[model samples]
Target: MPADPESGQGPAAADPAQQQQQQQQQQQQQQHADGRPAADKPIKRYRRTELEEEEAKKKLLLLEEEGDEQYEEYVPRKKRREADEAVLMRLQGLAGPAAPEGDDDTGSEIDDEDEEQQQQQPASKAARPASVPQQRGKESLLVQTARAKKEAPPESATDKVLAEEADMMRHITQKQALRAAKELATDTVYTRSMSTGWKPPAEARGWSARKAQALREQFHISVAGDNVPPPLPSFALMKLPPPIASLLQQKGIKRPTPIQIQGIPAALAGRDIIGISFTGSGKTLVYSLPLICIAVQDEMMMPLEGGEGPLGLIVCPSRELANQTVEVITQYTDALKAGGFPELRVMLCIGGIDMRAQMDMLKRGVHIVVATPGRLKDLLTKRRMNLDICRYLALDEADRMVDLGFEEEMREILSFFKSQRQTLMFSATMPAKIKTFAESALVDPIEVNVGRAGAANLDVIQEVEYVKEEDKLAYLLDCLQKTAPPVLVFAENKRDVDAIHEALLLQGVDVVAVHGDRDQLERLEAIRDFKGGKADVLVASDVASKGLDFPGVQHVINYDMPEEIENYVHRIGRTGRSGKTGIATTFINSRQCSESILLDLKHLLKEAKQRVPQFLTALHDPLEEMEALAALSGIKGCAYCGGLGHRIADCPKLRSESKAQERSKKDYFGSGGFGGEM
Candidate 1:
């Protein structure tokens, strides 16, 4: 009041020097009052400085307050009393739980972290005061359930007030959230029990090794009385005649694959065999070895077997596969020296090629005929060929052959095989229908489920990305360019396939579409190009998923998720095959999200660590527990192995022997063998 501070007259008048200082102070004050910071003071030029700082402080305070509130909210109340009661019971160690015996959490297999969350969740139901509950006639409710009769404290004079004032505030905790989620999961599963009748997989009966053994010795050999077949015979010892074995050796056939070893003997024995060999598991060798051996052996054994040529037959689902079969036969048999091994004759009859040429070949009395079901049916219908003389029949792609809608042709082909004929059906995937085909085609066949059939190979670096549908093509382009060399990109539709083909063509990215819409010749050519390494990337629909098997392919990209999970297995098998490692990348877009697929993917991950990508984290496990329970409800494992509870191979005895060898080696070395206390 004496003098305005900005004016500075009062403080400045005492001394000239003091007045000078005062004047400086007044000058700064005046500057600040003018809505500008003092010249000496730092200023915030950004407009949000004060407001943002204030808001930040406010938010911090509010968060602390909210946390307190959340703590208080955990107090058990009527609304959450039941949940609270359950938690209280669990906390008091009163769940009446047994020990972790055999992972028997069929009702509620909540994880450990989830159980803690449930134990911490607020009670939703609790006893109320007489004013609120007298109308319901309150029973004598125990005050503290955490204690026994001898230990429990009596109800306090004002226990309600103390309980209400229990140093807490209410807010949602992680435990509460987890418990709620667990509750939702349990509710979903409990409401819908997951029990269903077991129906063994189709073709399961025919593809078994035992059945094959039974078929072989029972029909082919004269073990009429008590002569039972021996345990799993070697592939080298399969049904092929001595001449055929000598021929295969000339072709450098060294070690036999499990399927080949197990399947060949059974097939040669004229057993109906459903062979569930994985891709590149030498399933072809199993069927082909038997076919050639039986054809030549039968031809040689029965001089009257000389109707025309080899009597064995092979039917593949696709021309590409049929072509491969024919090529393999040609290569395997090219070394034959004998009345030409009697197995020497090999022919190809598939769709799109000239019928007259096939007819001409058939007239030559070919012994081993590899044909697509459709084309073979055509030849049979037109009387261009007849299977009446065939002794061995093999359905190479029995499952896919059926899936491709060749039921009628398959039946017709089966009709030509007499009861004495040996039938073998092999598939990458064995759906139920394959079993039906086996029962019809096979006579007491054996079933086999190859290893990791539902799993993407561990050696394959499987990757997935979430992306928009519109940008998928661009992403694909980027991936192709980045991946380089060999990459297979799948497309959802034929239009998409064509578009990608054209786009890739523009970029000089070697790509070709292999789909049903394409002319049969084009499809075959596309697959051939991929196999021959003429095409770097194969862009196609489901056709490339199964039919085309290119062992040289280093990469497989799922530009679109396969319609079913089984297809995913087969598609990825195209890569990481023939004991060579490969990579597969599946792009997950919103469009392809479905409960069934999501659940399948989850189980796929849980069972097969070999297929788990190094980059996969908990975040990538996008399946919702509730959705999984809902999807898995009313489903049972296939009856053969109790619904695939364990891997089909990896015999315990063999594993023991391998372990014994490893242990012996360790003992000989006198060092810790495998980083363990051995």
Candidate 2:
């Protein structure tokens, strides 16, 4: 009843009698109290428009004739339809006698027909019903919808997209739909396909335990941390830019990854180290910093000693990866070139063009030489590429080096290295075989391993799709036809490899085929073609899974499921690399699969702790995720996000790639590492 302090006013325009009562209330606040200074009258603030709107709403509700009780109905008035003839009149006036009166209706009919046909066809895929007549308003919308629903491809946009949405929901797994979306809507298109069989040799049934042991030895890890590493030493103290340091800090990479931490220090100390880690781990930096450090050598420049071939020698397994590493190394080199290395020269000796040019470049005198095992071996044997002056020797991807059957070559290359030179062997896995190879190649060296490629990297999704045995080819065709981007199709035998390659070619699809049956030059050609984007698909055997790198491939299809699970690991490893987004689809059916295969498959899924996606069909029902997680127990960290998560969705770098001019993030598909036969 008293005027509020914030607003010294009572309700305005009250009745004269009420105004008198209000005056009494005001007087009470000044000691003529009637109820303890009259509960400080609650403030009432309202704008003129708001007050009028409330009043108008109340009046409308009060005037409602039909409503029984007082209720303000939320009446959103329907918009009036525009006159259809008005557009016709305007068009007729413009065109005069040239446009007939009914021309507009005919045009509308044609447009409706096109829309109906488009709606009927599934997204990204070509209209499969060659004979189905295009029906617009000929049938009831309900009837046509029902028929089209049944007729459309199961992997099409209709099934994946909710009808309620204005736009179709996308299935990243549908290649055809994604391509269509790209063309039709000018949106980034993503396509996917599923294949069941064509297993890699690592997952082959014929391989004996000795072979598994041999494969294991290819990447022999001597150092398994007795305890979790003392939270890695941070590189924050190195004083880098915010963006670069942010990634380093996020990974808790204060000092460096294990490989970088160990290898960098040893190489800086001018000692050799045999470093091993997973593919995504930072191995380039491990050897690079030390190389740069050695090159600078307290002289604030990449001092070039004329006639010195190179100060550092980097031998990689694949040309693509070698090229990629050179790019990263060069990026850092350029930054430090001003103060540390002004005229640092890096010579690349990898396959895909001319050896003469490479030799010419090498002879020009460079500070660093990045090369592949075979090309370097060839050059070394030819005495064109020399390491006599090279003090630091780094074997990037050592497992792939051995796996690609370059151990003998590596041994010979190492014999040329002086015992005083530092030798660093980096790989995904380090078994006894790698150790023996290293023992023969390297001297006493510090051992460092961040992790091995044991189970699937969480970001690299691994799943199995069961198709009927007869449907395998159709499934593969559907996958290739439906999935966009490049695919690496793995086949068990050379015959199936050729069959699929020929079939894809007949479909007017660009494909490259590689297998053991093919000669070295031919395989190299196939790989070169695929890497160049001249070939869209590659049908290959286990050899492709070795050190072969083609970074653009977004999908890996098992045309025939690899009987041995490790082969599956190697096959998919082709798609998902360096923390890029990739998918692996394995075709599993009754004929190809058995209890043991499913068990191994299930075991992998269990170890990954990922639920079997609904797209994946199998004889046995998938286990509960919590149970799998409990069984697997191990927490998998995303290489990109480091979130202890799985899949591309959770990977920060991958997510950024899709959103951030990422197509060139690093080809998941890369140039071939091995030579194919003619």
Q: Rate the local accuracy (lDDT) of all candidates.
A: 0.57, 0.57
The Cα RMSD of model 2 versus the native structure comes to 30.3
TM-score of 2: 0.48
Off by over 4 Å in 1: 1-253, 301-310, 337-343, 452-459, 481-484, 610-678
Which model scores highest in TM-score? 1
Q: Per-residue CA lDDT of candidate 2, range 260-314, in tens?
A: 5434534555444667665455667877766765665523444455455677888
lDDT of 1 by residue, 1-678 (tens): 576766656755646997688788888777688666646567433322234446656766777877754422222222244455456556656552223344222334344533534564442123332223212324455743333655867765334323332221111011122111333345422221111121222443335656755644532322211222232444343334456566556655565655655455455554556776566666788777656655555556664233354377788777777887788778667656444544466778887887777666666667778887777777777766766667667777676765565766666665554324556677766644235434543344466544533445555666667778889888887777555577887776888888888988998877778777788877877777877889888887876666456777788888877646667777777787666788777877656655435445545655655444333333333233223322332212221111122111212222443466565553444455453336
Query: Once model 1 is optimally superposed onto the true structure by TM-score, how far is the C-alpha of residue 318 displaced, in angstroms?
Result: 1.6
lDDT of 1 at 567: 73
Clashes of each: 39, 66
lDDT of 2 at 133: 28
